[model samples]
Target: MTERKLKVYSEDEAKERLAKELPHWYVEHGWIRRRYRTNSWKGTLMVINAVGHLAEAAWHHPDITASYAWVEVRLMTHDHKGITDKDFQLAKKIEEVVQWQPGLEGGALEGTPQDDLRFAYIKYDKPKA
Candidate 1:
């Protein structure tokens, strides 16, 4: 099947749509970006893998930069030469998958020592409890 031509969003349109649909993401340069902070290197790798899978499935890829404790995801429609709806859709999916916590799922953490492992969920620096 032939792919539909993507429509690039104007700067104002992109900013407005992003503000409503993806408040955590911001437009910079020519891309929409969001940075996820992980707890460790393991968490960073997990985020990268998840983003890779999602991007592959969507057939729309993002520029990813991963470090020991953070991953930056930048999305733009290279074909359209700007940010488009495809970017927004993929960004939303990435946010959902990355924010998921294994401990919140039913019985998934039973008998597992949670403190010893860093999961893929985005977390900020906080005081130890």
Candidate 2:
């Protein structure tokens, strides 16, 4: 199914954006948390650069914290007032770039243990004709 693109229409256009785009990341204290794991500080910086580029291109900005292993991004839409649509859009864009944990990027596996082990019960599988 296609995902619904959330709407944003507020004076604080940028703030509004965060509510939709980074639903999971955008939080209290007037900040959104975006976490990404990297091989080193250099890699982390590269991602920050990319995110910066994204922010600039979108004409929206975020406060970012970077370290050797991780980067935490905080987005707040300053123009429209509070959590505008643009913020959400940018959050989605940012989500495309970073990942914190492995094997859980998109989703987890859905098959039962029998799917992996041979001679195991395969209820999901049908008898061959």
* Highest lDDT model number: 1
* TM-score (C-alpha) between model 2 and the true structure: 0.56
Residue 37 displacement (Å), model 1 = 0.2
Per-model TM-score, in order, reads 0.81, 0.56
- Candidate 1, residues 62-124, lDDT tens digits: the string is 999988889999999998899988999999899877765545566756432446553324573
The ten-residue window of minimal lDDT in model 2 covers 119-128
Clashes of 2: 18
Error of 2 at 80 (Å): 3.2
Q: Write the per-residue lDDT of candidate 2 for residues 13-115, one digit (tens) a residue.
A: 4445455554446455654556766656666776789899999998789888877767777766665345555666687887765433223334674332443
* RMSD to the hidden true structure, all candidates: 4.1, 12.7
Candidate 2, residue 38: the lDDT equals 60
Off by over 4 Å in 1: 102-121, 124-129
